[model samples]
Target chain A: AQSVAQPEDQVNVAEGNPLTVKCTYSVSGNPYLFWYVQYPNRGLQFLLKYITGDNLVKGSYGFEAEFNKSQTSFHLKKPSALVSDSALYFCAVSVREGGGNKLTFGTGTQLKVEL
Target chain B: DAGVTQSPTHLIKTRGQQVTLRCSPKSGHDTVSWYQQALGQGPQFIFQYYEEEERQRGNFPDRFSGHQFPNYSSELNVNALLLGDSALYLCASSLAGVVLGEQYFGPGTRLTVT
Candidate 1:
């Protein structure tokens, strides 16, 4: 079984400061992990994914995530926080079946970037 | 290129009623996947369609069904809907037979079951 967990329901960060949203996962096979962000009443926007090779994956909006094999964590991070970055972020794991991909997502963390 | 698109941005239905949601994949994408997202929770996989056939499914019951057209468009149908069915219905599209590539998503259709 493949599952994802985002421990924090909400994370608050001050502008210009670094921010982090934690995620963990469990998969029977090699994991295909992803990070997505959703604005108010909007669809999920792709951020970055960790398929293989690189432990650090860079994505849109100057955001990045680190895939830690030992810790089983993929935490989203940004060096400088911006109020516009405030949104709901989700971590997902992709499982292959029947020639298609099914994603199991974490409950998500709402990031609140304060000015 | 136009991203994935879903019809009927909002829907309201009563229990036991049937509902059908439509989706068109992103340009050049041939796989369409459906997901149900409850308020305050993550999106749950429903099923995926490719080449006019179902390729994968999640833990959803038989009441949830779907179809894919030759054009790669898809429709999600729910029979005898329950209050728990109220949520955002998201449609995602991917290329190359749903490989680990990025899947683009539509704005989603909000289904309100009363």
Candidate 2:
């Protein structure tokens, strides 16, 4: 079984400030991690993914996530936040054991980037 | 290229009724996966279709079924709908054989079981 945990229900940060949305996971084998963003009443948009590469994976919209194997964590970070960055963020994990690639996502963290 | 697309953006159905939602995978993609996302919750995997066969499934019941066509489009059918069945059904598409490929999701079909 695989699972993801998003510790905070909501994260508040001011515009132009750095922001971090925490995520952790548990899986039997090597973990393939990913980040996604969702606007109100919209579907999820892929942000970034950490398959097997540099611990620091850069992605769309100036967003990046660090895969920490020891800690079993992948935290999404951005240097400066904008009001438009406020949205629901989800962290997911997947492994190749099953024939299908199904992602297990976290409960989700609501990001509020205010000016 | 167009991304994954789903049909019947919003629907209202009575309990005990059956509903079928449709999806057209992103161009050049060969696999489709279905998920159920309840309000205030993350999406839950329902099943995955590849080569017109169910490759794998999650913890969902048999009431949740699906089919994949030759062109890679798919349909999700749910029977005996319950209040809990009311949720946003999401369809995602990705190329087959790509290890841990990032799936592109559709806007999702919002189903309300009255």
Model 1 CA lDDT for position B59: 96
DockQ of each: 0.89, 0.90
Model 1, residue A79: C-alpha shift (Å): 0.3
Model 2 ranges off by over 4 Å: none
Which residue pairs come into collision in candidate 1?
none
Could you give candidate 1's per-residue lDDT for residues A8-85 as a string of tens digits? 999999999999999999998889999999998999999999999989999999999999999999999999999999
Residues B1-114 of candidate 2: C-alpha lDDT, one tens digit per residue? 999999999999999999999999999999999999999999999999999999989999999999999999999999999999999999999998788899999999999999
Best by TM-score: 2
Q: State the local distance difference test value for candidate 1.
A: 0.94
Top of the candidates by lDDT:
2
Model 2 accuracy (lDDT, Cα): 0.96
Q: Can you write out model 1's per-residue Cα lDDT over B18-63, one digit (the tens) per residue?
A: 9999999999999899999999999999998888988899999999
User: What 10-residue stretch in candidate 1 chain B is worst by lDDT?
Assistant: B96-105
Worst 10 residues of 2 chain B by lDDT: B92-101
Model 2, docking class: high
Candidate 1 is graded, for docking, as: high
